[model samples]
Structure formats: C-alpha cells, structure tokens
Target: MFFKRPTKEVERERNQRLLEAVYSTKASWDHARETERAVYEANVNSELHYRSRIQEQKFLYLYKIARKFKVHGKLNDGVIDR
Candidate 1:
C-alpha cells in the first residue's frame, strides 16, 4: 500500500481517535465485568435459598418418620408398651 507522510494535524487527529476508541473499549469492559459480578452474586443467593428449602423439607420428613415410629412403638427391638 502507498502511504503518505503524516502531517502534524493529521497525526493529532488520528491519535485523538485512537485514544477515544481505547477509552470507550475500557469503559465497556468495566461495565461488562460489573454485570457479570452481579449475576454471579444473584446465582449464589438463589442456590443458597434452594438449599435451605431442601434442608427444611428433609427435616420435616425426618420429624414425621420419627413421630410415626414413636406412635406405633416400632422403634428398635421392643416389647409393645401400651
């Protein structure tokens, strides 16, 4: 490609354009990183909520089973106590 020698004004304009482009790119990258961080935190919160619910359900199930065994007097090797 044939290239002409860059004049002072032309070089200044080109540098300005490059600087602006770099600034915009950096700003966009920063915004993207912030968005990603927010999404990650939300996902973590949701996962913890789900886990807590699952644990609560499991506790309730165990409680019901224990109550059933106690009422029927079927826990362990047992002589039926009326």
Candidate 2:
C-alpha cells in the first residue's frame, strides 16, 4: 500500500525543527571550543608566572650566599661581584 503524502504545513514544521536542531548543535560546539581555548591560555599564563617567580627566588638565594661569603673574606676567588 502507498503511504499518504504529508501536508505542506506538516512538512514545513518538520523542516523548521531540523534546522533548529542543526543550529543548536553547532552553537554548542562553538561555545565548547571557545571555552577550551580560554582555559588553555590561562594555564599557559599561570605556568609562565610560576617559572618567573622561581627564577627570582633562585637569584635572591644566590645573592645572599655570595654576600655572606664575601663578609667572611673566604671568597677570594671573586666568583661573585663584590
């Protein structure tokens, strides 16, 4: 038996629903991608800040040690600036 053809109104409603579903899926994907990119950038910035802080600490420690040795006259090799 042949199936009856759908009316124009029914066909239009179906097409509208399909288009809405497609647009919704695309919007969700776009939002997810943007969020991921933002998170990645924040992580990179945090890591760089951490490394710079560590480097500064190292320099300060070295400077303190060099000064202590210089005061004792035990660093005649002049490895660090007087």
Best by lDDT: 2
lDDT of 1 by residue, 4-57 (tens): 787878766765555444445545555545555667755654654454455555
Q: What does candidate 2's lDDT look like per residue over 1-82, in tens digits? A: 3799878888667555554444455455555455556677666546544544555555455445545434232333548775
Lowest summed lDDT over 10 consecutive residues: which window, candidate 1? 69-78
TM-score of each: 0.47, 0.44
lDDT of 1 at 8: 78
Clash tally for model 1: 0
lDDT of candidate 2 at residue 57, scale 0 to 100: 58
lDDT of 2 at 62: 49
| Highest TM-score model number | 1
Worst 10 residues of 2 by lDDT: 69-78
